[model samples]
Target: MEFLWTSFEIVGTIAFAISGALVGVSRRMDIFGMLVLALATAIGGGIVRDILVGHFPPNSLQTGFYVLLTLAVTIAVFMVYRSKQDHHMSTRWVRRIYLTADTIGLASFTVTGTSVGVYAYPQYPIFCMILGILTAVGGGMIRDVLAQRVPSVLREEVYALPAIIGSAVYYVFGYDGAWLYASYGSFITVFLIRTAAIRYEWSLPRVY
Candidate 1:
């Protein structure tokens, strides 16, 4: 169980780092700025969750491994995008890659966050779902705010709904130590919903 949880966290972190760094590069941020953006987008939610759960210092800052990993991924993204941004980056391929990374990050982080909630506060299932959704989307919200854009969750996109739904489903059916498969199922649900929203421009109805 411990190994599986760690695996999910690592996967989510790597995916978030890639997506965050892509945002920085897309925004034309410098290397340092990119690092900052990546840090916020990759582990901001985990930090928030730790604080809320009374897990002081947060896991991201614990052994410094998360920071180092985020830093390395951002650096790689910086190098790649620096050379390509002005030349061939306008293709559909670039857009698809960014969307793909974001979708993956969303799914993996949702599971990891919910897992923490389940193990930490099993008695309060609602809190587990809340933490899961927050952990999945909080970093991206921070990233967007830093970039001076509206957070996607608050936008018309059906972003948070999928995470929310997945969290609730996981809390109801998963969360048992025997349900690693349940976590994966929730992950896939969120990923597919978000990806389809992007691919089809699905959004909630607006009052305007």
Candidate 2:
């Protein structure tokens, strides 16, 4: 179980970092800006979750591994973008890459957050689900705010619904002694729904 959780965390961090770095590259940011955005998008939600759960100092701060990993990923992204500066990458292709990375990050963090929340407060299933959604979207929200864009959670996109469904799946199956099933099930649910939304241009109804 611990190993599975750690695997999700590592995957989430890397995927989120890649998404953030891609955003930075699109914005023509420098290496430092890319690093900052990547770290914020990669670990912001985990840190917020820790604080909300009374885990002072946060686990990411306690260990340097996540920072090192984010740094390495951001540097790699920067190098790749720099090397490809002469090429004409289409906006559609870049958007596709970003969506894929963001979806993976969302799914991975949804599992980790719901698992931690359930383990921490097993009696409060609703709270666990909400925590999972928040954890899934918090970093992306921060990233969008830093990038001066409207957060996707507030957009018409079919975004948070996947997290909600994924969180519910984890909370239901995770407590049945089938941790692997629950984790993978939740991941697949989110990934599929999010990808479908991207492919089909699904959106929630707008009030205005």
Candidate 3:
């Protein structure tokens, strides 16, 4: 289970980095800036998660491999995307790819954070759940801040809500047997909900 969780974390990091790189590409950022953004988005959430849990040095820091992986993924994504523009791919296709990658990263990281919190510190379920939500969305929040745009998590389209709900479900089901099943189910639920919300243009009603 630990190995599985770690695998998910690494994949999630790569996915998020790719998403960040895509955003950078869209913004016409240079290669160096793209790499920087990707690295920040990939590792920011994990760093915050560790700090919140008092895990100094942070797994993202200790594992140099993760940094290398983020760099490699970013470069690869940038290269592929840059080349495709010359071939005249539609802007809509590029946007779809970015959004899809972002959603996957959001779901995967949410599960990873929640699972880690549940396994490592089951006594504080609420804190763990919040950490999970933060870990899932924190990178994008930072990216949006750096990019001078409104963070998507703050909007009504069932974005952060799905992460919160998934994290809570992970905590609840994780208490029983079949932790992996529960965690994966929660992740899929969040992903599907977010995807549906995007596709159907669903939004939470504002009381104001």
TM-score leader: 2
User: Candidate 2 on 78-134: residue-level lDDT in tens?
Assistant: 887677755475667777788899999999999998988988987899989988898
Clashing pairs in 2: none
Off by over 4 Å in 3: 85-88
Q: 2-53 in candidate 1: lDDT tens per residue?
A: 8877887888888889888888877878898889988999999788778778
Query: What local distance difference test score does each model get?
Result: 0.84, 0.90, 0.84
Per-residue alpha-carbon lDDT of candidate 3 for residues 58-169, written as tens digits (9 for 90 to 100): 9987969889999999889877776664534577887787788888888888988888788778899888789889999999888887877788788546889889988988
Candidate order, TM-score descending:
2, 3, 1
Higher-scoring candidate on TM-score, 1 or 3:
3
Q: Deviation in angstroms for 132 in model 1?
A: 0.2
Off by over 4 Å in 1: 85-91
Highest-lDDT candidate: 2
Off by over 4 Å in 2: none
What TM-score should be assigned to candidate 3? 0.94
TM-score of each: 0.93, 0.96, 0.94
Report how far residue 200 has shifted in candidate 3, in Å: 0.6
Clashes of 2: 0
